[model samples]
Target chain A: MAPSTTTTYTTKQWILASKPTGAPVLSGPDATFKLQTVTLPPLKDGQLLCKVRHFSNDTGLRNFIQSTVAPERFYVPTVPVGSPMRSGIIAEVLESASPSYKAGDLVMDFHLGTWSELVVLEAATSQKLAPLPKNLSLTHYLGAFGASGLAAYTGLKFAGGAKPGDTVVISAAAGATGSMAIQIAIHLLGAKRVVGIAGSDEKCAWVQDQLGAHACVNYKSPTFVEDLKAATPEEVDVYFDNVGGHVLDAMLTRVKKHGTIAVCGAVSGYNSDEPMALRNWFELISMRINIKGFIMLDYMDKAPGILQELIGAVADGRIKLQDAETMVEARIEEQPEVWMRLFSGKNQGKLITNLIV
Target chain B: MAPSTTTTYTTKQWILASKPTGAPVLSGPDATFKLQTVTLPPLKDGQLLCKVRHFSNDTGLRNFIQSTVAPERFYVPTVPVGSPMRSGIIAEVLESASPSYKAGDLVMDFHLGTWSELVVLEAATSQKLAPLPKNLSLTHYLGAFGASGLAAYTGLKFAGGAKPGDTVVISAAAGATGSMAIQIAIHLLGAKRVVGIAGSDEKCAWVQDQLGAHACVNYKSPTFVEDLKAATPEEVDVYFDNVGGHVLDAMLTRVKKHGTIAVCGAVSGYNSDEPMALRNWFELISMRINIKGFIMLDYMDKAPGILQELIGAVADGRIKLQDAETMVEARIEEQPEVWMRLFSGKNQGKLITNLIV
Candidate 1:
């Protein structure tokens, strides 16, 4: 029962050739990441050969390309020099040697060491997605129904614990986690008012219109402070800090007494060596704000229960799956370029490379 | 049934005359506070005429003397110019008009409009001290058994929720609430290590030797930062933030992951119009520090229950309530001078002016 694919696959992968001093160069001779071509091993018993369909490029990758990441609070090990960069992908099991996976079965792996087009996955590695009862694309799993969605659901549920009709505010509202957070706060959690803060007018418009957030304010606008105040008249009951900076300072002043703040990520400060200090922390005293920091790793024990709820919500149409991604139909050689665009804000929502092209 | 008091009594009270732009002037003609003499009317049916025995001078009083205090978060109304400054005291009931009051009964009132030597109080306003089962002094009601003690107990229980063998660090360790906090963390909570941070060498000695803290670091020392690190080798499990500012910034860097910081007060920043901004809040994310701001007012409903535990612990000698007060036996007019001593750290523990002198 051999598959249609050839016995050998020439896989092009990106590896950390040199530690990045500042921003990593993805290609060329002086690039931090250098391309390599390798032959895949023959599929063994209990292993499936998965062809990576879409590559998920994320902010966490920024922490790994450094020379060392011991004390950076990353919780994960640094990518060593000359090692393949870790990636997440929606892959198809073209050939299988185990009962758990079969041909034509689609799966997703959040932690994969190799960015190659062809990957021999262990049977225990990735999740075999259930039949999509709704007309949802597999790409939705990487953005709205995947790690980001579960993170949003679990973080908000425990950190903020926003009640029905509560006012919820989210930062980076057009990005992967923020987009999912806003939708969950509004539709699933029954929030009365959901305000979003994003960097550009287009991102704010996408957060407000496409994601159905009640209001969105562009942080780049000249009157961002006044605009934020005007938008959130009821004051914030729950604030999801997706990007840590002075924007958090602004929200510190606007959150109500006894409000909650969920520290989900600090994407805004991830690239810069010198992130700005928050100046409005005294608000924590007067307003009695509660802040909790969490990641998806904290709640992995409840992943199946959380995923079930996410799937049910999407199927029931409470969480309308939004196309909030910028997919590049590019070859594996172009991943470095696509990954670099995340820092300059050139890409939308979740950035992915469609390796099939 | 009036027992032993006269129909009218002469009393001296302090009233605010002007707003303080910086430090308050407490005496002389240029003083923001002015002394006033008034004749008290005869006590009403449900009121008791009392002779004030002790006046409690506190950091919170600084918030009241200003001309306006709309937003500083004292939780009480601002003292209007020409109105008597608010106070707390231990008083003796000289005469009674209701069943709850009897002559020679001792009572404590946390909130009073006058600082007079003699005045009338509503029977419902103050707590009549329960008969002492141990040889605890009536002064203990103003120090270890009073508002400060209740604050440390409730705040640590609910905010930090420290378990046995946890390490606790406290700032302002020689002051009212701080003194009580260090004892509770070690004795009642069974914390493994308790470290105290104070402003002076004398205070540090008092905290270490007299208060029985495991270690005490003087913030005034040139090697304060290193000294704190040496003192907290186990890393901080719970931090009781009684004084906020640079000290808090230091703790933010030293706290263990998932630690708790109870914001009891911000003594260092109370008088300053420009309190220093915190620069180390990013540690909150990496450490997952939980901070909660609370005053005694928040738990007044549970006051009776909390006070009982404090009393039992002090009586059983579990919390060796130390002598930690600067008591002044002075004339009523000299009250301003004694109150001013708090700002200069001239007093120890609770500052009290004994009115009987």
Candidate 2:
């Protein structure tokens, strides 16, 4: 592949047109993310212009919108309309003005309002990507070794207190973050039991087979609580809460004394006007459980260490990265539909929107 | 006064009447604790016959009739119908067959059931009282230096994570345990600010004045939330929660990041058939708070150390013990009315029925 030059090019971009209502629609009064043609912004002296190859659609972005429902309850606004939608992206640097990188360097940058072909990111915010190891695909880095991987690592390490012989239960177990957490708990931390609670029987099998989980229970089962109780008879030591609602409440009821709950995202209530009633929260006091909610942006300092460990794990086959690649080379008008597919649980793994091929 | 050698004295005793409905009435539907005159049970080789001097009434005693509640949840259960009521008491050893204690020695024992004039206790359960310091009253030892003192010390030390400059908030601040916790936080731990949340204006004032609380708020006020917010703008660092319904819910909203909440009791919900609803528990995750429910019995190993520290503080006048002494010297049949006073909140401090004058 030949290296490309830094050229000012006009590309179609999607901008948040409206705030979302309950269960965001593809096109509605709540959201109208419109596609428009705009000139690529010029890179500053310490910035780089990169061509975004893969853009991420994640549960956190959905939560970012609902956090604004009750502004006083949250520390910050969820997401603002008329702004570039926040995302994580893997891009190739075409132009660099900073000492950190050159024209042909590939980097993982979070300046991914990357519903676009080109993004101008500051060198400080742009992370130079290490060469993908043999047999590892570039899309794997965007999913498992990128922001999602680091989030799982730090969340389990700090909040989950992942330790040997512990039982870790993860919601949304088939998703990038949850799958990463399951692998980290089992392979890295020597967890005795890694249980996954997913939405379907297929995801349950994937979590157990592909992610190396000891057991996986479909939370959609009418007998979900009984199955979870049977699966985790010793009670969960660490709960990696991703889809927080009834699953979270059920998990709380089964947490062992002095257990830790890592609240990564609340996908179940993300688009709802009313937040789910967590009836079992009183268990927190009785069981001495520590439930901590966090955003990965707060732990940016640990990113390098996380990426190194993840890459090493993948290369050694201790961790498997399953990239659910959905290549979309369509016009910008189809962006909202692509993003909405994530909420429908159609994507088995990381839902990456490939802007160019 | 010289001690008498006669251990065969007959005394009238109150047996557990039928349990009452709603607020326990003096007269029960089954049988008001009948006046029973029986021969005293013989003391065993390792037991002492303790002539009950004072029997304390606490909110925990109410849980006995509710068999559905956990045995570990309360201090003692109401006496089973026709059985002697169990309680904590200050008694004098009238006769002893144990090497651990001598006849005529004053002792504090957990077998209060002092609705009777005599009770038998094992030597291991009774602590021989030091000669009451000329400056310290024996009643004060029973009130502050007994279980209440140990509860405060343990709550602050283990559960509250209390440090020198941390702000400590105590609920039910005028009650025996809350008052003791306030003094321990302020004087023993050197907390920067000790706030007390009490039920009445007078009790709030007493918490600040007698217990050395930095400030006190009456939670009964319509502006309790605002008043509490104004009182604790820095946010609560340690909350020793005794009354756990609305007070705990309100405190949850104002707890600082990484704060510790010691869930000592849920007196507010003790009598309610429906559990209190706490809607803002999501703050626990956002603030990274640690809320733990504890029973002093769980930390009994630290009892001797707690007693030494608390006794020294009380003797030195660093910690003041306020005696909410509602003296009742009545016949055994009057026990029901005495027990009823505690539920009405009519008793100021420790409600003790003085069997001896």
Candidate 3:
């Protein structure tokens, strides 16, 4: 789409109303977000006015919106109580104040809030991207070729020391990072066996059949424990953990000697008032296992190179990512419900909301 | 002391009678050990007939005497119901068929059962030591220059990555391994501040005053947690955990980013039927801590050189072990009571039983 013809522009944003109690509220009388409309101010040099086209509904905002965090416990700054929520979005460069971008050019803003329909981005944070048809999907920049992809690549390389012929077990296999991890483990890293743990039977089937995982176990199933055992006859060498809790404890009992557990996220514990207490920590000593946690921003220096590698891999059909992307057509007002899809396990693969009509 | 001069010498041995219900029973009706008497046999071509002079009473016997262990959870072989309990000992060779050892030579046996007054050792397992004045104390070999010493040295080197000016916190600071760890951390590893955790005020004083630790905290004190906090104001760089459970949970909250917890021993949980649960596991991810468990046998190849280094250090007055060697004199029948002192906190430093008289 072309830039809007109107000379004046206004946008609606969801601002934080109160500190969260337990989980963040998406709707109703107790909703944490208060809707506000604001007129755009004159853009400064080295800035671009962008209209958000597609935005990722992710758990990143949940980590930063908390009232207070211990200095050592958090990696990023906490979102102020009245500030607009932030997310990753693909936006169109409309009425650029900077010489680097022109009108109608598409860009990816990894952290700029898409709660507003129109956002002003500094040149430093805005990444110029190739337009549609030449690129696989605008959503791909926010999903496979973005932060999710970088986490999967580096978590394995640095923490797990992923090598050829290794057996990897990935949790939250239907989610963004886990799905990418499965493909990277099998296709790029040459893992001998790749087993995935997902939330539902349909998600398991898609993970195994579509994402090329050797085996996929539905964690919701009654026989999930038995199924996981049957899937990996060879013990797990690297466990890429996305949803920590009972899954981490279970993997603790199943890892090979000197195995590595790369903790990418803890979706299972993020919203709970009390995070799960792991009882099998002694296994760390008994098994000589090494478990590590990582945030994506830590590896941004290596992102551009890996993003090109991922783009080339997808362009050459070396890695399959399209089948794993689950997108929804939603405007700015529908983001709260779209983000809710992640908690309900209703979204398959990477959940992206398309704002374009 | 001279070798036993009886032609037909009879030896008393303690054999495991039954599986331990919780902690092994000593001298009661439900005692796990049964006494046996056997006449000494002639030495074989590759064996030595040795008179056990001094035996180290250690926690090593507790792990193997259990009826069964999960294959993945255990490193050493489990002692069958009727087998003798083994420990490290310093002994005098009475007769030898192998050319490597001769009559009256002192040797250290790291794994041979000293539940007997007399025993046979394979030429392969026996380590010949230098005669009296050339060696510091016969008990020193069992205390700081033996398995305990090696565990401290290697646990720091490989697991904790002990470096100059590191703030290393050691638990069980009055016990054999922990005392040596304090010396190794300060003198050898060049630790800037070493805080020791011991079971009693006296032990803590010895750890601080005698072992040259910067500070020492009594874990039994009512204000232990606060004392520990006051002791480690700079925060812990490496925690040498000899006692697990709440101490582990407490230290989990104190470690600096990228700090290590070398799980050398878990004396707090060894005899309990159910091990204590650790609730602060999320700290591992939040603090990015690396906690590892290691055994001395894993580094036997490097033990000889480090043992020589320990001997030289103690000899040159750089490391102190003289105040830490606690000795007991009793016949073979007193083994169970001596072992119980370790659990009751009655024994301090390196408890060695002298069979010289």
Candidate 4:
């Protein structure tokens, strides 16, 4: 809260120290972040100050730093060097000079520079999240009910055109968006079978046993293709592709006639300089598959309805919030390390760093 | 006409002699066709005998021969070696035993073996075209009123979703379907600027001057990309792609956001053992371009309506059958050579063979 006394607050943030050479690491000569503190300026007439509660890590952050040479090339606004990293965050208002936001207001900023101890913005910029239900945790607001959740839901509904009894497959099935996509395919869309592609046996087990998916395959396993085939004998009707590359190619070969691929992310190639060589692209014509690449920004108008349905499903237990059970939590200082877990496949479920206790 | 005497009739046909080593040749070690003769069998119940009047040469004929080793892979059935070459044909009924047809009837058979002087089939197997309109020739039934016409119309209307004022570009713009596509995009679809990509300057001139396309680019020129850029300053809104190789890749770079690419054919790769390397396929996701590869067989139910509209357009001079001017007429015995003109980009317009005349 702002004090009448001449007291000032300083904000700590993780800035883009340098571009990563390849896949990012927390402690290396090629490390891509630097921590810094800045003195907060007086609140402007339309400005509001927020204390970051929790912010979600995204593979897109890697793309942001690497894509700085051509920020306009990406869908989202890229974070400039020396600027605090941009991310989706759930935050509490600490001070407000605007009529729209008051102290203690919980807001979700999809475009905010949130890998920091504090965020200050015009009240109109961020969306005030609805009050959390008693049964659902605030993590749901960041994972299953936030941008990642909306990505999974909209990508399936709009891109994949998820229908009842469709055999849906999700890559990166242990990640925040993929896990939600797996459950959405089953509970909301009534998919006949759901296959999850993860990177480890533990993640695969959790994806299958904890998430109610029909099967889960470790993509790192030698029998990855065989396992995927065995799991989806009828062939995939909707492939919610989060990890594009070899996984996308494999699904392309197996997609049923008129199947759709919801390309939400390409995590596998975000760190690489070369565009992945896709062999099975010809199948896009052969099987008459529809490959739609989309971002949540394109589906903002549909977000409210999707969020409502997702919240209702999670509350009614139709959607098991398995991401909460295996949650990976870290402090604001560990943002780089926690985010690295996403790239290294060490993170379990939704990876978030708590900026405030 | 049936023979007045009880003399037996022998039908001459072109049969698949052997698979081509590469692109087929009419007279070489790589010759893919052979001439054969067989006595016409007596008409059975519900059967009719017809003499092939004119047969259309399609780029798909190349795929048919190449796909024979694995016939099930292609959308249409493949022709076996030693069997008559199959194609779309306009024929005249010589005799009939079914009530559906009678002697002297004009029929259109999409799946008939047309590289022959005669064909016999059940009356239900072919559609009896109405009496030829006074303003139209028999070639109209095989071009503007037949499968190629439907391919162009359906590709632009259904697959491309071509709309008024859209900047439509058609690859292989001097070929059969592309020629019609150029006109349909301008006259029917009301595209503001239609760009045609042909292989030669003469063909490009005909595409722009005769076919009413706003501009035509000779793709074989070393400055093809620059020429295409100069021609389509506003960029492409709908690309009716008949050639899928470097040209398709080039178009992908110039396509407007949310453009549609109707994959009608890939003549560049038909005879080559190597799959054309496509580098810009990622644009399919970035631009949210819809790339649909289709066969006319999928839209046969809509063929009649398309044919009716096309016939009206032809008669009204709305679609300049300018293609009729450059028609490549070949004897039935020269089917192999005429078909090579499709891959070689030597045929000017709708390539057809005179079977009876």
Top-TM-score candidate index = 3
lDDT, candidate 4, equals: 0.78
> What tens-digit string does per-residue lDDT give for candidate 2 at A125-220?
777776688767777666787767877888888767888999999888888788888898888888899999999999898888888899999998
DockQ of 3: 0.29
Candidates ranked by TM-score? 3, 4, 1, 2
Task: Give the alpha carbon lDDT tens digit for every residue of A1-357 in model 1.
Answer: 877675776678777898766677666687888778878788888888888898887876776665222354445556788888877788899889889998989888876636778887877778887667666777777777777887788878777788899999998887778888888999888899999999898888888888899999998789998999899998889999888777887887888888889887776666565534654555676667787776667778887887778788888877766567777887888887777777886555777778854
Once model 4 is optimally superposed onto the true structure by TM-score, how far is the C-alpha of residue B79 displaced, in angstroms?
3.5
True-contact fraction in model 1 equals: 0.26
The CAPRI class of candidate 2 is incorrect
Comparing 2 with 4 on lDDT, the higher-scoring candidate is 4
What TM-score number comes out for model 4? Answer: 0.84
lDDT of 2 at B125: 69
Query: How do the residues B120-189 of candidate 1 rate in per-residue lDDT, one tens digit apiece?
Result: 8888888897776577677777777787787788777776777789999999899888898888888888
- Which pairs clash in model 1? none
* Candidate 4 local lDDT, A178-291, one digit each (tens): 888889988998889999999999989988888889999898999987888788888888999888778876787778777888788777777766555554555665666777
Global lDDT of each candidate: 0.78, 0.74, 0.79, 0.78
Clashing pairs in 2: B64-B77, B87-B112, B324-B349
Give candidates' CA RMSD values in order: 5.4, 5.9, 5.0, 4.7
Give the interface RMSD of candidate 4.
Answer: 4.1
Q: Which candidate is the best by DockQ?
A: 3
Candidate order, DockQ descending: 3, 1, 4, 2
